[model samples]
Target: MPEDAPERVEGHTTRRVLVTGAASGLGAALTAAFRARGDEVLATDVVSTPLDHRDGPVEHREHDVLRLDVTSDDDWAAALATVEERWGGLDILVNNAGVAGGGRIDVAGLDEWEWITGINLFGVVRGCRTFVPMLKRQRSGQIVNVASLAGLVHPAGMASYNAVKAGVVALTETLGHELAPYDVGASVVCPSYFRTNLMDSLRGADEALGGVVTALVETSPFTADEIAAAVLAGLDAGEEVILPDPAARAAWELKQTDRAAYVDQMRRQAARLDQLA
Candidate 1:
């Protein structure tokens, strides 16, 4: 361990975990990963889809994240009511529900931006806000918010997605600070491209908004299982932000070294990608 690095909490065997967006992608993987480790896992998603493929037991809930709209108090109340009834108290809360946004700032519609921010950014805020009390009651609990590599380094071609994820990163950091008094921990997951149904989900949303964003998903590399594994390891280590991939970690380093230089580099990379297309 580094001399200045914070000590990590040991991973416990009997933790009760709730993962949102558990119908598919990283959330599903996380649910399975937790279950495999003998943790009681309750998986929730808007869609009711069977998640266990390996006889790895996991409870399921058809949760509508948008119904709570994170920004609405009424919705948060209803969602927390459901949560309380299910687990009684939560040991870990993973806010993983999100959507992809297509179009540039000059062309992207405001409604699309609103929808993206509501789910990607405000969703984390709502989850943390509502769960802090539950976690405090437990005395020790962790909250993990799923951001993206774009959150660390806002890239072009997907302005709204970048902006919303960046907001998640910021919100998670601030919440981590505020919740310290309660012994409630917070972490943000920032990952690069992961091979999962994430692209299919984005493609569906893109159909309603426009079809530009699907192309980006089609070309990305990485796997949800790998990302999930890294996240579990990070949680075991009590990291504030769990970065699973090299591109994402490098982006964080670049941001720390030189913000302007990082922006310039991303601009040049975006131009190169444009040329490739």
Candidate 2:
């Protein structure tokens, strides 16, 4: 995208959307989704890796991909400052930056817990803390935080991932209450097995367990783009909790209707994983 591209589309009310973790996977897909709708997006991540922008809707827009480490307070301040100065104000904030440390609590040390939580939970806290004031001043905005179905239904060997994502779920649910009076809507997306590289970055995780996760996800019917589609639609409709995959929706319902059964089922799944290991 050109730096001097038009701020607004000729006849459309272009929205100013800032998406974190936009270097790949769901974040990149969501950025493209918004860009396809002609919105100005600030796509950010921790690195400047070359992106897959071919045939993307961002071909003729002002959506620049930037390097932003979400765990850094200074990075949050600088990123928002750039948005405030260049785009004038923020309309949509997607805190999609997160990490998954794929191991049980016993295998994952306190260090792993702290690492994933820094980006998964506290990063979201900082994003909302930094931008809510701006949104309140503007009197309208939306926030989308990416959690996981693991938050709804815990599985084995994912204690840290489950822990941080559950916190994100709680945080975003509370954010909805706090932002309503200011007319700022909040959403927490609980995505199930999608074809993202989430398992690839796992720290101190079993290689066999990672393979199992990848196989399950790759065999699923959903993709990153499909999840992004659900997220964009839910955001447009002001839906609170966005469950993008059928497995996620099922798990959410099971948690609501039969907590004991859900736990038993997960226990069996854990037993199977034990056998595999």
Candidate 3:
């Protein structure tokens, strides 16, 4: 253990957790859930302000909220320093910061691709790179990377989003095996469309496709809080790949059980998008 590491209790129930992009949506919900469960949560986001409770309430009574831009190495280093100083060590790291983006292959520019990749895929990459060594040294801790259902079920007009989210899934799966020897568990959350402010960060050239995605997000029955609850439960169950919602589970099941049908469905969706265009 490091000199500053906190003494590990034999049966410590409370965890020291750091969550990224905790200002809104699922990130905020996860922070609230962890805190509610008696865990010490360090909620960090790019914004240096308080949680926007307009979406929903998250306890903010002097709890540590740091400004962490996931794309910035300096910010990640500063966050790691804060964790070591304040908590001595971390029990969990949630790489949940990401922006929504999608477009047809030809329509979405390379700049947009780079932008989303920086914050979505590479953001998670940086978090894991920065923290995995510490977790390995400690031989403890869990990493939960928040990916989208699109990561598993790729659809039309979402090439950029699908690719990056799939990258997150692959990364998390690989970490699951690679970190197991060190006793550090990894899980990737793939949730279907849920009621979230994810659309607020959406950047894409295809307005119609963006509108369709926004509608799916807004009209979904599930909420971020609900998904957060499922995630906590999934973590407790030690699940490697957490499909947090019914839709996600169903889609994945379909793909696994009926490959031809799944491909046909994807093709049909693509044709529909084409019609809309």
Candidate 4:
């Protein structure tokens, strides 16, 4: 242990955690967050790049990086086997693997739609489906699926992204209800926007409108580490909808109070996209 590192909580049990998309973004940030709190983390990304964990809890682990594809059954099985063999049990799974894709829904082709849905939506679906049994058998575990505010607020140009994340939100909500009886926790994250690499994977997006989205993201008052901390706090408190920022929280309230009003407001905001040209 580092001399200056914060001490682990007294009597705190170390949790065995698996995080997808662990190479970067929320995954990498949250992996460090879990490790900082003395939790054992299995960080997986489809890309096999070695993680730069030179000085963290996972720095001295037997393996710091595990290659697992969120969209592949073989990969999920292999990852579970590795976890089973190493830890003999699992405690936390953060299904954070996803891609960003958007444009006008009318012009967004089937190929891009499939590509985004495959990675963003189906990827989360596979993670939940594959890990639910383990969690059920243990009768206690946490599943955190990362959705987006786009799911709750349907803006223009993000039709597919909205659909996928909304599906995640709904699926995880239902899963939470099902897991309540077993004492397992389920949560869906609906963060508005933070600084992350999600923008790097955008597909079929209009350049002018993309600039608007990028501006909003970059100018947002939140950071990825902040989001990660929010995730940890939310999970620790057993919160179902983990809205990481004030913007997301307020929007959530609006949607809950009046769906038609929220939709009208979103339609008004999305009208700007048409003027972007």
Best by the TM-score measure? 3
lDDT, residue 55, model 4? 19
Total backbone collisions for each predicted model: 1, 0, 0, 0
lDDT score, candidate 1 = 0.72
- In model 1, state the lDDT of residue 54: 31
TM-score of each: 0.80, 0.90, 0.93, 0.91
lDDT of 2 by residue, 73-143 (tens): 89899988899788889999999988767675565678777888888889999999989999999989999
Q: Compose the digit string of candidate 4's lDDT tens values, residues 153-179.
A: 777778888999999999898999999
RMSD to truth, every model = 7.3, 3.1, 4.4, 2.9
lDDT of 1 at 5: 26
lDDT-wise, the better of 1 and 3 is: 3
Clashing pairs in 3: none
- By summed lDDT, which 10 consecutive residues of candidate 1 come out lowest? 203-212
Worst 10 residues of 3 by lDDT: 1-10
lDDT of 3 by residue, 1-277 (tens): 4342334546559899999999998999898788767787888999866564247454464548899999999999999999889978899999999999989998889999999999999999999999999999999999999998999999999999999999999999999999999999999999999998889898878887998899998899999989999999999999989999999999999999999999999999889988888
Best by the lDDT measure: 3
Which run of 10 residues does model 4 get worst, by summed lDDT?
A: 52-61
Candidate numbers sorted by lDDT from highest down? 3, 4, 2, 1
TM-score of 2: 0.90
Q: Give one digit per residue, the lDDT tens place, for model 1 in 1-277.
A: 4342223336745776767777677887887777667676666666544454232444443332224344566766776787688668878889987876655556567887887777778877777878788888777888899999878777666778888888888988998898888888889999976666665545222242334345445566766778899999999899998999877787789889998999898788668546544
Model 1: residues with Cα > 4 Å off, grouped in runs = 1-11, 51-79, 203-216, 219-221, 258-261, 272-277
Better of 1 and 2 by TM-score: 2
